[model samples]
Target chain A: QQPVQSPQAVILREGEDAVINCSSSKALYSVHWYRQKHGEAPVFLMILLKGGEQKGHEKISASFNEKKQQSSLYLTASQLSYSGTYFCGTVTTSGTYKYIFGTGTRLKVLA
Target chain B: NAGVTQTPKFRILKIGQSMTLQCTQDMNHNYMYWYRQDPGMGLKLIYYSVGAGITDKGEVPNGYNVSRSTTEDFPLRLELAAPSQTSVYFCASSYRIMPFINSGGGSDIQYFGAGTRLSVL
Candidate 1:
């Protein structure tokens, strides 16, 4: 099953902070995050394993909650470059070879 | 070092027509996946393969078929195309490195193609 992401859309001013959440009904083995700009393929951000480790890339960080089967991406000091659609892909405990992406969250960072 | 390459960046197909979206990866990754993204929506998996000669269906696999004849190529075929199938298609591959870490093959970081935009009239 596909993961569910919160905040369908959000607008932020420069330097503002925002959080996007992704929750799955199945047991999550790992969570992957990516950002997609207009007319561009999705770019990898970071991956968090089920060990509850928080992974970070630049000002963007993500936390995985194994118990809750959820993950959250945190963006601090947002930049115009951060404006794009954020997606969370989940690898379930079922050992599926494919990563199921979430519903997606559109984030726009204005200058 | 081209990560992933997709041919026919943009295409328009008439109803009931068929076409194949070609995807090739030079990274020689063992895993490949096909997904479709509608405007303002998240990606939906169409099919995936673990390696050559292995394929499986994903969340939304209807109206689509795939074959992984070689490790470098995984093509998605759309038959009897409909307007609902018109969307941006992406092909991705992952190495699935560090198997000893997370029991489930650790982490998989997927490298994506530029994507093909298809419109069915």
Candidate 2:
């Protein structure tokens, strides 16, 4: 099943912060985040495993909550390059070896 | 490496027409997937293969078919195309990551092709 993403769309200033959340009904083994610019393929951001670790790179960070079966992506001091659609891919505990993507959240960062 | 390559970047097919979208990967990955993306929507998996000669349906596999004849190639076939099938198609390949060796504890990152834009008239 596809995961659900909150705040279908968001607009932010270049120096602002934004959060995108993905939730699944089933138990997830891992969550993968990607960002796709207009007319481009999705690019891998980061992957969070079941250990509930919070991973970060630059001003981008993500957290996985095993208990809630959800994940949240944090983009701080958003840059113009951050304008794009964000998606979260999930792998369930069923061992199906299939990755399901979320509905997606569109974020537009303005100067 | 031309990680993942897809052919016929743009195509238009009449209703009832049939076509095949070709995908090839040089990364020697064991897993390949076909996904479709509609306007303003995330990708929907249509089919996936674990290895050559093995294929399985994904979330939305109603009007499509796929075959993995060789490790390097996986093709998606559309039969009797309909207007609803008009969308952008993407092919991705990835290798399995060992949990013990990787802290991420999941499959390797998927490399996507440029994507094929199909329009069914």
Candidate 3:
């Protein structure tokens, strides 16, 4: 099933912080975060595996809660380059090689 | 490495016309996927392959088909395309994680293609 993302859209000023949440109905084995700029391919940000681990990339970070079947992407001190649509791809506990992406969260960071 | 490459960056097809979106990965990844992204929406998986000759349907596979004849190539076929099939198609590949050895640190990072924009009228 496709995951659901909260705060369909968010606007932040430079240096501001924002959080994007992704929740799945099924148990998840891993959660992958990606950001897509306008007319560009989705770029891999980070992947959070089960065991409630947290991962970070630059000022961005993510946490996965296997028990809750949810993950959250954190963007601190946002930059203009941070403006993009954030998507979360989830792999369920079925151990399949498929990834179901979330609806997406559009973040626009202004100067 | 070119990473994931897709052909025919833009295409326009009439209703009922069929076309194939080509995807190739130089990373030698074992896992490949096909997804479509409609405007203002996230990607929806159409098909995936764990390895050469091993393909499977995904969440939205009704209007499309896929084949993995080689480890480096996975193509998506749209038979009798419809207006609903018009969207940006993306091909992605990733390294499959072993059962327990690399489960904790396996690189599940999926490298994406440039995307093919298809318009069906």
Candidate 4:
């Protein structure tokens, strides 16, 4: 099943912070975060494996809660370049490694 | 490096016409996938292949068919196009499992193509 993302859209000023959440109905083995600017393919951000782990890169971070079957992405001190839609792709515990993408969160960062 | 490339960036078709969306990856990856994205929705998997000569259906494969005859190519076929099939299609490739010892995990990180936008009237 597809994961659900909260806060369909959000607008922020430069240097602000934002949080995007992804919830799955089934347990997940791993979660991947990506950002897509308008008219471009999604760029991979980070991936969090199962075991309630957390991973990050620079100002972007993500956490996966195995027990809750959910993951949250945190963008710190956002920049104008951060304006884009974020999606979380999940792989379930079934071990099939079939990816299911969340609905997505549209974020706009103002100058 | 042309990591992944999709043909016919934009196309238009009639309701009963048929067409193929071509995809090729130069990375020699073992896995490839096809996904469709509606205007405001996330990508929905239509089909995937573990390797050459192998293919499988995904969540929204009802109106799509796929074939993976070579390692570098995987194409999605719309046998009978419909207006509902109008959307942007993306082709992606990934390693079956990360190979490096220092790699984060066994998880597969996908690399996507520019995408093909199709509209069926």
Candidate 5:
């Protein structure tokens, strides 16, 4: 089953912030985030494990809510380089070793 | 080492044609998967193999077939192409456990290739 993502698209100016959310009906052992620019493969970002913790690098941070079976990605002080479609891959708790992807959130950063 | 390699970065075909998308991995991972991305839908799994000689169907397996002859190769076959099968295809490989590769918490991350863009007329 695929996870559901909200705010199909978002646009922001430089230095602005944005959020992309992903929710799944099944509990997840981990949540992985990837970003895809036009005509390119998705690049890995970070993964949040089941501890309901947060992991980040620079201006990007993500939270995994074990109880709610949801994850939220926060992009702070957005930059032009942040323009791309973000996708979330969820590893279910069933131990299937399979990943279910969200529809994706297209983020466009303007000057 | 090259993590994963997919051939034919771009291709076009007429309806009823048949073709195969080739994928090979150097990491010696035990799992390989093929997925397709349509316009507004999330990536759909076409097929997956855990190890050599074992294949399984995924969410969307219609018009497609997969074979894992050896640990290094996993190929997806499209029989009688249709416009509906025209989309971007990606090949990925991962270990059963993250950090499953060699790094931290077993984050077993998946390395993707520059996807193949297929258009069927």
Candidate 6:
């Protein structure tokens, strides 16, 4: 099933902060994050596996919670280059070789 | 590596028109997927294949068809186009696990194509 993300849209300024959250009803084994620019394909940012692990890219970090079936992305001191749509994908291990992505969070960073 | 490549980067179709979006991956991945992204709606999986002769439906597979006759290619066919189907299409591939830490031929990190932007008028 597709995961759910909070605060569908967010606007930030340079040196500000923002957070995007993703939660799923089904148990997820892993969570993946990707960013898409205006007219480009979605680019992989980071992945967090179960076991309460965390991964960081530049100043951005994501945390995966096994018990809660949720993941949160942290954008600390945002930059202008951070403008884009963010998607969170969840994967399970029930022999179902498929991954479901969230609706997406649109973020606009203003200078 | 070219990773995943999609043909016909942009196309416009009238009502009832038919077309096929071709997706190919250079890496020999067993898993391939097709997704459509509408403005502000994120990405929805339309179809996916686990292997050469296997295919499955996703959330938004009603207005589309797909086939996986070969491991190197997965093509999505629109028998009749509609305005609702006008969206950016993306093709991706990956393994089930472990692309974050270890480098492997097949990892969970899905590589996406440049995408095919389709518009139905």
Clashes of each: 0, 0, 0, 0, 6, 0
lDDT of 5 by residue, B1-121 (tens): 7889999899999999999999999988888899998765567889989889999999999999999999999989999999999999999987774443223444456778788999999
B1-121 in candidate 4: lDDT tens per residue?
Answer: 9899999899999999999999999998999999999887788889999999999988899889999999999999998999999999999998856432234564478899999999999
- What TM-score, over all chains together, does every model reach? 0.92, 0.93, 0.92, 0.91, 0.93, 0.92
- Ten-residue segment with the worst summed lDDT in candidate 2 chain B? B97-106
Off by over 4 Å in 5: B98-104
Better of 5 and 6 by TM-score: 5
Standalone chain B TM-score for every prediction: 0.92, 0.92, 0.95, 0.92, 0.90, 0.90
Docking class of 5: medium
Better of 2 and 6 by TM-score: 2
What does candidate 1's lDDT look like per residue over A1-111, in tens digits? 778899889999999999999999988788989999999999998888755889889999999999999999999999999999999988777654446788899999999
User: For model 4, what is the error of residue B120's alpha carbon versus the real structure, in angstroms, after optimal superposition?
Assistant: 1.6
Which stretches of model 1 miss by more than 4 angstroms?
A: A95-98, B97-106
Two-chain DockQ for model 2? 0.57
Docking class of 4: medium
Per-residue lDDT of model 6, residues B7-78, tens digit only: 989999999999999999988888899999886668888999888999999888998999999999999999
Model 4 ranges off by over 4 Å: B98-106
Q: How far in Å is the alpha carbon of B111 misplaced in model 1?
A: 1.1
> Which 10-residue window of candidate 5 chain A scores lowest in summed lDDT?
A91-100
Ranking by DockQ: 3, 1, 4, 5, 2, 6
Candidate-wise lDDT, in order: 0.90, 0.90, 0.89, 0.90, 0.87, 0.87
**Share of native interface contacts recovered by each model:** 0.83, 0.58, 0.83, 0.79, 0.54, 0.71
Q: Which ranges of candidate 3 are over 4 A from the true structure? A: A95-98, B100-104
C-alpha-based local distance difference test score of model 5: 0.87
Better of 2 and 5 by DockQ: 5
